[model samples]
Structure formats: C-alpha cells, structure tokens
Target chain A: MFLLPWFLGLVFITLGPVLVSLYLSFTRYNILKPPRWIGLDNYVELFIWDPQFWAAVRVTFFFVGWSVPLVLVMSLGIAVLLNRGLSFLPVYRSIFYIPSLIGGSVAIGLLWREVFGSSGIVNQFLQGFGIATRSWVATPETAPWTLVSLNVWTFGAAMVIFLAALRQIPTSLYEAASIDGASAWTRFRRITLPLLTPVIFFNLILQVIHSFQAFTQSFIVSNGTGGPAESTLLYTLYLYQRAFVQLDMGYASAMAWVLLIVIAVFTGLLFWSARFWVYYGDG
Target chain B: MGLAVLVSAMMAGTMVPPAAAQDLSGEIRFSWWGSTVRNAKAESIISMFEKANPGVKVSREPGEWGSYWDKLTVQSASGNQPCAITMQSRWLAQYADPSILQPLDDKVASGELDVTGIDSAVLDSGRGSDGNLYFIPHGVFYFTLFMNKTAIEDAGMELPPDDWTWDDYAQYARDLSDKLPEGSYAVGNQGGAMDTFTDWVQSHGETLFTPEGEVGFTKQTVVDYFDFWEALRKDGVTETADQMAEIPDNIIDDTLLANGKILIDARPANQVDGHQKVLDAAMPGQELVIHSYPVGPSGTGEDIGSNGLAIGATCDENGTKLTEAWINFFTENPDAAATYSSDNGVVSVDRFRTAQLENPDTTPGQYQAVNMLSTVGPRAKSAYFPSGGYSALSGALTSAYETVAFEQSSSADAADKLIAQVKRLVRD
Candidate 1:
C-alpha cells in the first residue's frame, strides 16, 4: 500500500512513455506530422544503412571505456587520501564533492568550453608562463578529451561514497595488520581494497551509466551542431540531432532503444564480473 | 423580479448588435522565438489584440532561438501545439503539410485575413510546395556582409563595392589582414556556411536543389566552392580554424567581428542594427556598413525569405477562428504592426514599412536597412531546402568546411563526402 504512489508513477509516467517510444521505434514518425507504422524499417535502416549509427557507437564506447576507469581509480585515490585523519575533514570533503554535486550541469559545461577554448583560461595560464598552447576545442583529436576531462573532474561524488565505506572498515583490521608487520601498501591491498569493493562496484556502475548518457558538456562544447567535423558527436548528442534537428523521431527512438540495450548489457557484464572482485565483510 | 430583469436584458440585446459584442471570443496561444526586445513587443501586441476584442485572451509564449524547436516538436506530436507558431521560410515547407498547419487562403477569401498590402510576390511565397497558403510572411531578410568601416580604414584599405568579384574579396581581405594588428583578422572562415555557398552557386546559375527536387550543383561546382576558402587560408586572408572555432555557434559576445578582431562577416540584413550596437558597445570607434554579397562572374549571389506565422492543427474550432482574427489583427492593422516595429523583422505591410521608415525614433542604420530590403523584397526567392533531412545537409556543409580548413584535407575529399552524405539522406 505504501508503494502505491511509486507504482502509479511507474505506470503513468515511466512505463507509459517507454512503451510509446518502443512503438515509435518501428514507425515513420517525424513529430511534426502523423506517425505511420512501417514495421522494423527504422531499426533495419539504422543498423544496415546509417554510417552515423556506427560512428556514434564507436565514439560512445571509447568515451565510456576510459571515463569509467578514470573516475573509479581517481575517486578511490582521493577518498583514501582524505581518510588519513586530516583536520578540517568535513570542509575538505564538501570542497571535493562540489564538482560532483554540480557535475553534468549546463553552467559547468559552458565553463568547460571557456577553459578549453583557444585564448581561454587554459591558454592564458599557459602563455602567462611563456608556454604555448593549442585550442583544445578546435583540434579534432583533442576536442573529445575536453569532454572526458569534464567527467573526470566530477569524481567527488564517488569519493564521498568511498569515504563512507572506508570509515566503516573496522580500523582493527589495519591495527592487526600493522602489528603483524604488514607494510602500509600491503594493508591497503589486503584490507582496504577488498573492504571497498562493494562501494567501488556501486560507483563504477553508476559512473558508467552516467558517462554513457552524458549530453550537456558535449553539447555546449560542440556548440549544438556537433561539428568541427562531428568529432565530438557523443551518442546522446547524435540522438538529439536526429530527433529534433532532423525531425526523425522514429529513427531517434530506435537509436534510444539501442543505447538502452547497450547500457543494460554493459551493466550486466559488470555484475557478472563482480562475483570475482567484490567482497563482503560477512562473507 | 428575475423575469423583469431578463425582459430588460432582452431589450438591451435588441439595442446592442450581437455580432460586434461577442464575435470571435476565445483564447489563443501564440508562440515565437525572439530576443527580449521581441518578447516585449510581442506581449504589447498581444494586449492590443486582447483589448480590441474584449472577450478574447491571447497568450504569449516566447523563447530564445535554440530550444524553440525542441519544445515545438513534442508539442506538435502530442497535439498540444499553440494556435499561432512563428516559422521560417526554410522551415515553412516542413510544417506546410495540411495535417500540420491550416492553409490561409480560405481566410483571405472570406476577408478574415487581408493580404492586399503585402506584395504579390511576397504573398505567393507563402504557398507551400502543394500550392496551398499555409504561412503568412510578415517581413523579409537577406544574407549580406556587415563590414567594419573603421577597421578597413585602419588597415588602409578601400571599402569593397557591391559589384566586387570573389577574387577581389580574397585579395582585399588579404591586403587588409597584412596591415592589421597581428592577432586581428579580415574575417572569420565562412566557406562552409550554407548561405554563403548558396549565394555562390546561384551566381553561377546553379543551385543547392533543382526545381525537380534533385541535387542542383555538380560535384565540381561544390568542390570549386571549397577550394575558394582553401585558397584564402593559404593566402592568410582568413582567420585560422582555431581562432574561428574559439567563438562557437556565433554567439554575439564571442564573435570576432563584435570584438573588432575581424573586419567583416555575412549577416542577415535585419540584424545590422544589433551588430552595429554590439560594435558600438565593444569597440567604440568602429562603425558598420551592410552591403550585398559579392557578385559572381555569372550571377548575383542573393536570396530572400521572411519570418512567417503558421496556424497549428491542434487548435479547437473556436481557437481556429480566433487564431485567424489574431493574425489578421496583427498583420493588417498599421497600429498593431508598429508595436513590433521590425524587431519581429521589417514590417510586412506597405503602410507599416513606410511608417517605420518615417518614424523619427528609427535609427539611420535600421531605416537604410529596411528601405533597401523593401526595394529588393519583390525579386527575392527563398532558397530551396528540402524537407525531412535538410538540416543534416546544412550540417554536412559546415562539416565539409571544417574538414577542408582544419584537417588540411583537400576540398575535393570533403566535397565527395558531403555529396555522398547528402545523397544518402535524400535517398530515403
């Protein structure tokens, strides 16, 4: 009975739209006109005919593969550093978590563009010291990395989760290890690492999912056209280009489902891998 | 007592005409994308509409340009579209289908919408591909170069004429850049812009799309267009790709032209005042002058289209009649038209255009721009952009431009990729 409101929302707000989009995926819909049923044509065209579809997949996968690991490792490292019994711990924690709190925000995206732009802060800072720099957004090779760096900067959220788990790890484990003559690295490797696996798994899956669907940074940096020869056309950006700019809602719907399946499969694989890596205190 | 009061009301109804008091009473939702100035003008006009017809309420929904379509698309599909939607000529064709927008001809015939003041050619442009009048253009715009007079003088160069060739443009810009400050440029690299290419192609007696809806220009035609920009880059006449990309998507504040770092840019004629205003604020001594696109060897590179109003299909029966009334009131009445005063664009009606030109408050630049547009309005043809995937084609143009300029790829390669991409989108 207590779950009634959520169940109602699932039916009306979530499930209803999901089903409509699934239905739209098989049709010829332009949003401005009536949607006509075409039965598998959109999916067929997307897979077999569209080069952009393949390009989007390649770009999105490349982004996800690197960004997920970077966030995982970096956040864990910072969390461990903060957990070393430092003064003003709460202040430091809040300061570090600020980026995550405002991660994927539009203002941050605009800020990122300014920092990476030619004649921007990055170049200004570099040149102030007599070093030359290139415009990160203009160079095709470096354009996508600007967006990656944005994601990496938001490691604070995961670090906070890691900090909480680190605090729960029963310091007796570390005390016993030290008394037994174990090295600091060895204590971390054997005790802290295993103890933090559950949080790592949590953060990793969430980060991967978040990274896959990233839109704001890429959109703002690329100036909404995803040009500079479409070098920074992330999957969601491309999906948006199709749906709104091209008015091809049917194809966009199909693209959305494909993205969903890709994310689900990746998440499933992570869970499968977790059996070997993730360890619990009780177990 | 109630029966006596009812008898007295019936007598009052006999004294007052029923048609004038309650005619076309309902609410209308009018949506448009505009600047803050435009939103204020639109709101004032809406209140004018509401005042003229006492019982009718006209709602104003104003948004900035970027997210207007993103919202419009969902609204259209959900059958929740506003009664009156502001549309562009290139986009008019997309919304022209009978199922989406109401054709305005019947209203014209019924005297509900008066089109007598608008020129015949301008009126005819409102017709969709199906020859139905689904849009009513209020005012027109043409793409032209906004040149900085002071900057050109600083560079010790003469201003280019209206009849200069492409070669002349490149040489002059190169010369201007030579004398300018080290970081400043003659212009941003705009070789990939669709409007620029359209002007070039038309001057050559070719086009982006043919009358029969096929690719109008040969591969060699587009390739030569690309090579033109490549030649400029090689000559150091244009800004580097990095410097150009530094200002993304032409935000006014970031524009090199606004910052006095660039001497010229191709802008829609109506925006001359805004550009000049920016220049006035940012670079106090700089003054801007608008001129026609360079005349090519074969033809003049000019096209024109106007912002239009379309009636969405979702309006209920009463809303439809009221929408017609609102449009007629907005376009036909000179006082109502003056409320907009070319912020929406140059006014469409002959009476209002003349009114705006004569108003002492109208700036000299705006007056000249509007005067020039009115003289050229009759001959301007809208560029032919095919519906369904035309925006993608435009994207391809910019993509090809970037590939040639930044990637150092031959224009031929970019052209080939563009042709193939266009063909693919058009194929379906």
Candidate 2:
C-alpha cells in the first residue's frame, strides 16, 4: 500500500506521454497553441483524403513485404551456414553482423546513397558491365528496391540471433535424425526447423515492428523528400513530416497511434499463427 | 584532502564578490546550432559576453541543424526553453506563442535592443502572426544559382547573364546534359526544401499564400510550374526528385562542384562557403560563381529569408539585459561578426563590417558571394509571414511537382489535385 505512490508515478511517468499522444490523435494540436477537439477529423482526413499518408503506407508495406522475407531467409541461411564447422566462422559472423550494427544509422544511409547514386560505385560497376545506368535513386521502380537492399544487407543482427538459436538445438536431435536415415535437408527440416520456431517467431515479431517504425534510413536516404514520387517515404517518415515539418502535432499523433495499431495487429497475428508452426519443446 | 582543499581554494578565488553579484547569479543556459566553424565563433562570442557581464554565466548547448530543432521543440513543448536561443524566420511564428516564448516588444521599445542600423524589412521577418517581434535577424540571406564554370564551359556555352530567363536556362541545361558525361546531371534540385518551388512560384508571379491566408496561385499556375519541371525531367536535364533527394547535402555539393557531375546547384546566398568546399574538392583550379536566379515569367524576383536571435519572454530583467547585450555583441561587434560570417560565406548584417568582404584569406568564390549578395540584396524579396496551413500547401505543391516530374501523374492532374488539396487544407 505504501508503494502505491511509486507505482502510480511509474505508470503515469511511463505511460503518460503515450496516453496523451493517443488522445491528441483525435484533435487539432500544433504544439504552438492549445489543442482544439476535432473528434475523428484527423483520422477521417488520413483515411479518406491524404494521398501522402496513403503513399507512405504503401511504401512502408512494400518495404516490409520485400525486406522481411529477405531478412528472414538470408539471416537464417547465414546462421545455418555458420553452424557448420567452417574455418574462421567467428570472423565471418562478425563481418556479417557489422552491417546490421551500423545499418539503420545515418552513416549507413549516407553510404547507401553513395553506393546507389548516379555517380556512385554501383553505377560505375554497371558501366563496366556495359549497362548504361540512369538515376537509380531517381526511378520509382528502383528506389523502393534500394531501401529493401539496405534492410537485407543489414541481416547481421537477425543472423546473430538465429546463430544463437541454432546453437541451442541439442546435438542428440540431429543424431537421432541421422540414425533414422534422415537426409541433410530432411534433418534440417525435422530437427533444426522445429527447434528454431520459437526464435523465428520472436524474430518475426521484432523485424516487423522494426520495419514498421523505420524512419532514419529512408529519411536520410531520401533527404526527407521521399521521392521518385514518394516511393521511399515510409510511414514513420510521413509521421515525422506531419509532426515536425508540417507542425501538425495532432495529425502526427493520429498517424503515430495508427502505426501503433498496425504494429500491434501485425505482432498479434504473428503470435496467433505461432501456435500452428512455432513448436515449443516444453509444451 | 589536499586535492579537496586546493579545489576549494580555486573555487573561492573565482567566486563572484557579493557586492558585484546580482540576484541572477545561477547559470543561464543558451543554445544554438551551426557547423563546427560557427560553433567556435559562437563560443568565443559567448565568452566575450560573459567576461563583459560578471555574475551571469551563459552555458552553451549546440547541435547540428536538424537535431537542434527537434531537441529545442521537445524542450520548449515541455516548458523548458532556454532563456535565449537562435531560431529561423519560418519557425519564429510557432515558437513565439506567448504561452511558450516571452514577447520582446517592451525591450525593443525601451532601446534595450539596438535596431537602428538593422534593415527594417529584415526586422519584419521576425514579426509573428500577431504582429509582435519574436526574433531579430542575425544575417540576411537570398537564393542564387551556384555554377560550375568548367561544366558550363565544357558544354561549349558561355555563362548566362545575371538576368537570364528560365527558358534560356532550360536550353542551357539541355545543352549541358547532352554535352556532359553520360552519368552527369545538368542541374539538381534539392526537392526536400520548398525553396525551389517557392522560387518557381515567385517567378510566375504567384505567392505561396494569399493576402487573406489562402493559397495564392491558381490550378493553372501550379500546372505550369509542374510542367516546367516535368519537361526538365523528360529531357533528362535535371536529377529526379528521388535521385536528388538521396544525395546527401555534402555529396550533392561534391557532385556539382567536386566531381563535375552537375553543373549548377541552387542554395541560399550564405552557404557559398560550404559550396566552395565542394568546388575545391571537384575542381581545384576551376572558378565557382554565384549568379542571380533565373528570371521566371511573373518576375516576382528572388526570395530572401534569414535566421535570427531572440530573447525568450520568460527571462528576468537581468536575463533580458544580457540577451540584448549578446545580440548587440554578436551582430554589431564588427570583429566577432566578421570572424563568424567569414567562414559562413555570408556578408555580415552590419554594413560597416567589411572585413570578411575584404579579407585576403577569403576565397575568390566567397568574395564573389559577398558581392552577389550586396548587388542582389536590395532586390531580394523580404521575408513574409508564413501562410496558415502553409505546410500542407507546400507539401501538396512539392508532391504534385515530383509526381508530374517523375511521370507518375500529368501536370494538369497534379496541379488540379494540389489546388484542391491546398484549398481544403486551408479551409479546415
């Protein structure tokens, strides 16, 4: 009973801003002045009229659609490959993980720009192959791909987690598979795959959340223009534009809440479906 | 114990005398954002102010430009704005909300602020929507086209005159695009900022906002602007919005002046020094020049804006005095202004401070920028109040421009949509 104050403090301090943001989502607050209650006007505008918001949503989904699967497969593949008794495995692991460590940073975004820009290394390489490259960053078709490649290139963090999960699988499980005359592919499917389901579920939830809230790389990469016609404008980037650039804090709050709902729903869906495929040894 | 005694002795020696000490003895925090060069200059200026005024200490909090605003906004929203701070003209309106920032009218009227020599037009830039002066202009700025002489010369074209038309500029761009290396762009627009669009709109005799706070341009005017960019995009004369957007500011500088991948770039007049670095990198021997913006159909001429210093309303009397002194010291102190403005590639607002303009250490390009600003400064449009729903209007225009330029939508379609969007945005 004595700790009630502390508990209330913790709850209010931690959740106060979030609750305020949620409430502000329905109003017209520009941070400079008092918030005017506008009911669901902000949400209505976002859903019914705002093309930029829709563009951001489309770009975000495209980013997640391409990036999530690529990250999952590449990281899992790299982790599985590292699980083998390869020479200098630790060095390779570090090398693969380095991009992940720095991938979401402004520095990496700057690097991505350099690599894919018109006069960048990628263009120079393409020129060597007798391919005349125009602006990769300028094209609607290729700009989204550039962001996808950026996320895929940073598979290092997921790879590390997958590696740890791979290590946790008992050697006896593989041995049993081998005794049963299981092929390498079969053993991987029956033993390694099932055993790693929980980790996969965890990674899926994490990656989706990370991908949904991505802002820095796209912001930096696009220089806050989000172009070739808003192809690279992510959801968070739009939220930032609304919040800071436009100074429509209330609208930005609404967008933030919407994003929260999006992440929540996606995460919930992953957890719900986990029961179907995510095997738990304890259960 | 010996270390503690020594520390106490040093502190006691440095402690302010009670008779000399005012009631405001605690540290007063101040913040601004600028490059490392500007930061050093600011530090020196603050030190000078502190030395001149005892009992009051000013703490410096600075960051890079983008992060600086974010931090300051978050802080201000939480009722924690610094007593004195730097702000941009566009942002003064939002930040000067009486609830957040204290008004400076009393100080200005009492002659606490020396606004005698400052340009009245420039002073008006700091005025909020409520007609209260919220900030004071630190430096005046205008937009200009910084050109790579080698690239233009390489294209076998002479440099356009100071008053070249957009049509002539487009022709030159087309010629440059064809003549330059395959990977090179004729010109690149920084699509992120509204400067390019604003310049375009002004050239067409349209303003971003109307007198009554509506969008000034018609649907047709927007279409014409979009069409112009679309033509450039189709002709391969300009970098796509995505391409231009992806280029970091530094790399964009390098691409134009350093690598000669681009022949022309548009930037604020004050940024000539930074652009010179790009030129120095790409073309060490080549001369860089700042020319007037291409004349648009409307002939509204070039847009000029500024960043300025402001004293918060929350400051006490002593704080107010210190704020005035700081502003005077920073702006009117010829040597301090020269030192800061020299590296900044901008002319000091103080007309008497010719040190930067005449400095032997100043680059040829820097000197040219100074001359350009002086020559064009009088003609530049004074800063105006940002329109209500200006962000939405600007965003709609930018989106329309990009959409049309990238061939995702027709110019007419984009223009119509933009007009409708702006009307709706302003209406609400």
Candidate 3:
C-alpha cells in the first residue's frame, strides 16, 4: 500500500519522461512547434557529425573514470576511520558530512570555481609554500580535475553508508580472527573484505551513475559556456545547451537516450559481475 | 430650430471627448529578465499605472537573463506564456512564432498600440520572418567598443580614432600593456565571442550570414580573425587565454575594465551606465568612453540590435489592451524613461532618448551610449538572426576559437574547423 504513491510517481514522473524522451529521440522537435516525426534523424546527426556530442562523451567518460574510484576509496577509508569507536564520533560525522550536504549545487559549483580559481585561496597557500601556482579552473587541461576534486571532497554520504555497513559486520568474527593468530590485514582481508563486497558493489554502481550525470560543477566552473576551449563540456551541459539554448529538443533527447543506454549497460555489467565477487550475508 | 438641431447632433456625437475609452480594466501578465534595478523601476511603473488607471493589475514575472529564455520557451509551448513576453534580438526568433506572439501590425494599425514617437526602422526591426510586427522594441542596444579613458592616459597613450583599423587597435593595446602595471591588459579578449567576430567580419565585407540565409563569410575570414586575436595574445595586448575564459558575461561587474586592468573593451553601449558606476566605485573619475568597432580590415560596418516586448498568443483582448497601455506608458512617459535611465538600452522613443541624455541625473554610461549612437549613425546595421542558427553558430564559433586560443590548433586549422562547423549548422 505504501509503495502505491511511489509506483504512481514512477509512471507519471520518471517513466513518463523517459518514454517521452525515447520517442522524441526519433523526432525533429523544437519547443516552439509541434514535434515532427523524423525517424532517427536526430540520432544519425548526433553520431555521424555532431563534434560537440563526441566531445561531451569524452568529457563525461573522463569525469567518471577519475571521480568514481576516488570518491569510493576516499569514502570507504573515511568510513573505516570513523568506524573505530573514536571519542566524539557524532561530532566528526557531522563535520565530515557538511560538504556532502551542499553537494553538486550551483552554489558549491561557484564555490569550487573560487577555491580553484586563479588568485584564489589555493594559489595563496601554494605561493606561501614557495610553489608557483597557476589558475586551475581557468585552464582547460586542469578545469575538469578541479570538478573531480570537488566531487571527491563531497564523499560524506557514501562514507556514512559504509560506516553503517561496517557497524553491521559481526564483532564476533573479528574477535575469532584475532584468537586464530590472524594479523589485522589478514582478518580484514578474510572476513571484512568479503562481508563488505555487497556494499562496495552498491556504492560503485551508485557513484558511477551519479558521476556520469554530473553537470552543475562543470557548468558553473565554465561560466555556462564549457569554455577555455570546450575542455569542460560535461554531457548533460551539452544536452541542456541543445535542449534549451539551441532549441534542438530532438537532438538533446537523442543525447539523453544515448546516455541512458550507456548508464544502463554499465549498471547491467556491474550486476552481472556481482555474482562473481559480491558475497551475501546469508551465504 | 437650426441651432437646436446642431446642439442635439453635437451632444449625441460626444464631440468634446471620445468618451474616455473605458479605463482599460484587466490583469496583464508582464514577463522580463533584468537586474534588481530594472525590476524595481518596472514594478514602480506597474503600481503607478494601476493607481492612475484603476481596476488594472500587472502580474510581473521577472528573472535573470540566463534562465529567461528557458522559462519563455517552456511557457510558450505549454500555453502558459505570459501576456507580455520580453524579447531580446538574439532570442527573438526562437520565440517569435505566429502561435507564440501575435503580430503587432494589427494593433499598430488600429492605434491600440502606439509607435508615433519611435522611428519606423526601429519598428520594422521588430518584424518577424513573415515581415509582420510581432514585437515592439522599447529600447535599442548598439554594440560599441569602449576605451577606459583613464587607463589610456595612465599608460600615457592616446585613444585611437573611431575609424582606426584592426591593426591600429592591436598596436595601441600593445603600447598600453607595455607601460601599464603588470597583469594589466591593454584590451579584453574576444576569442570565442560571435558578436566580436560579427564586427570583425562585417568590417571585412562579409557577415556571419547573408540576408538569404547563407553563410556569408569564407573560411579565410575565420582564419584571419583568429590570427588577428592570436597576434594580440602573442603581443601581450589582451588578457591571457586563461584569464579570458573567466569573464562573467556582464561587463558591469567585477571585470578588468571596471578595475582599470584593461583599457579597451567590446561591450554594448547600453551597458555603459552600469560599467560607469562600477568604474567609479573601483577607480573613481576613470570614465568609459564608447568608440566605434575598429573599422574591419575590409572596412565594412557594425551590428545593431535591441530588446523589446512582444504580445503573447495566449493573451486575451483585455490583457493585450492593458499590455499595450503599459508598454506605451513605459516608453513615452518622461518620468518612466528617466527612471529606466537607458538601462534597457537607449530608449527607443526619440523624445525619451533626448530627455534621458539631457537629464543631469543620467549616468556617464548612458551619456556615452547616446553619444555613440548619434556618432555611429549609418555605419550601424542590424543583421537578421535565424533562431537555431544563431545559437548553434555561436557554439561552433566558441569551439573553433578555443582551438586557437588554447594553442591546440593552428589559426588556419581552427578557421577551417569553424567554416565546416558553420556550414553544417547552416545546412541543417
């Protein structure tokens, strides 16, 4: 009974837009006019000739490749540290989680620009340390990495989930491993590693999807143009440009569907790989 | 008996007055994008209008420029478009559908909307692709390059003449940068800007697009333009490629020009007021002077454009009537015009434009804008921007220019890339 609203919302909100976007992918639509059925023209145009589309794909791929693993490892490591019954545990959790609370907003994106900007705080500190500093966000080659750092910094949510998973692992198992003459690394590898696979799998899939859809950080950093030579043109930002700025809804829809398929394939591959490594508590 | 007949006829005819057209009573939904200042002026005008003409209400829907079009496009398609839709030249065609904005020709003919104080060319410029007046511009924005007079004097360099060539502009910048404080630039970068490119190519006797919807300029044009900017960068005249990328579109804010870090800037004449204010705050008495775009190498001309109000398709008779009244009041009234202070570009009404400049309260930017408009006469020509083509072309222009700006591609290669990209878009 409780799931009824969610199911309704899925159909009306999530699934509805998805279906419409899929259909629109095959049409020629500009927002001002009625959509004309063009039958895959949009997709053909995007794949065959749209240089920006290809650029966006590369940018998105680059972001995901770096941000996901960085976020996962950092979150897991922080979670492990917090799991150690340290004094003032709650305070530390709140302090660390603050960055995540403001994650991926335009405000944070603007903040990231300042933090990584030319003559910004980072440069001040670097110059103080007798190191030469260059504008990180303004430079095309380093702009995306600034965004990646921002994404990695906001790892508190994943950290919290990992912490919860850590607490659930049987304390008896760790005690038993200790009695069995196992070292810290050995016990962690034998018992904790296998037990945490499911959570790791969950976090990986979630982070990958989130990282793929990243837009705001890049959009804000690049001043909505994906500038300094299209170096920071995240896929969603490009789609948004096509959809709203250029008024090419059909092309944007095609881009959207392509992204959806790519994410779906990755998630499917993750699930397929899951049986080989993810250990269930029941087993 | 004759006198009585005449008196009866006169009484029946309402000869003294046309029986004050029923006080235009209705709610008009006015939408626009602006800064806080524009919004405040518009709202105050709205209230004054409502009070003077009882029973009328104006539902204001103001926003920032960045998201204005997104909201307008959605509202237009969704049938929720406000009765009064604000229109900018670049985005005008995107929303100027017969099904979106009612052609104002009929309104103008019937005297429901007045255009007497506006020049016919300005009125005609608002015409849709169908050559019908679907939009009515209240103001005009002439794109002109500005010279920070103080910066030039500080650099001990004289200002370039209005008819200075592109080469002269660059040489002047180099001279300034050589003497100015370190990190201070001689000119602002215009590598990826379509507007600046338009000015360049126009001077070269080719526009980005011809009247018949063909790409007017050649690949060589793009190469030469890229090379011109590259020369500036190489000579340390303009902002570094990295610093160039950090500009926040609006010229009035925390920019090198405001801070007196750059002497020459390409900005709309309308932005002068805000630019002057910021300049005063940053480095008082350093005024911005408007200069004509460097006569293109080909010696062609510059582009003229404006922002205006368009009546939406969904507006009912009463809503449109109220909108017409409100638009007229805002345009023709000296008080309203003075309050706006050429903020929405130079006031389109002749009387208002003259009145604004003549007012002592007017900012230096407004004064410079009016001066530039009068000075750049006949040399300014507004181009036709087809909806999707303009935005896509702008994006492509950015990509091509970025290649050269970032040192990732040669000027020739970047030009070829730009030409091919524009061709693809125009063909589509």
CA RMSD of each candidate after superposition? 5.8, 8.0, 3.4
Candidate 1 has a DockQ of 0.50
Tell me the tens digit of each residue's lDDT in model 2 across B1-428. Answer: 99999999889875743223333344667888878878888888777667656666888988897688778777777777787788777656557667666666776788666665666777777777777888777776677787878668867878888777888878878877888777678887543346766777778777777545567767776666666666777677876565554455554454544456677878776566666666667767665677787888767467776677777656776666666677766666665676676443353364633566667877676677677766766666753545335466656666666676566778788888787767655532
TM-score of chain B of each: 0.90, 0.85, 0.90
Show model 1 residue runs off by greater than 4 Å: A1-4, A281-283, B1-24, B211-214, B314-321, B423-428
Candidate 3 accuracy as lDDT:
0.81
Q: Each candidate's iRMS in angstroms?
A: 2.2, 3.1, 1.9
| Predictions in order: lDDT | 0.80, 0.75, 0.81
* Model 3 regions more than 4 Å off: A1-7, A179-181, A281-283, B1-22, B297-300, B420-428
* Native-interface RMSD of candidate 2: 3.1
Error of 1 at B168 (Å): 2.1
After TM-score superposition, the amount by which residue A30's alpha carbon in candidate 2 deviates from its true location, in angstroms, is 2.5
Residues B156-214 of candidate 1 have per-residue lDDT tens digits of 88898777888888878888878887778787677777778888888877877764556
Best by DockQ: 3
Model 3 lDDT tens row, A1-283: 9999999999999999989988888887887788889997888888888787788888889999999999999998998888889999999998889998897788998888888888789999999999978779878899888988999999998988898999999899999889999998898789878999999999999999999998888888887788768889999999888787777777789988898899999999999999999999777
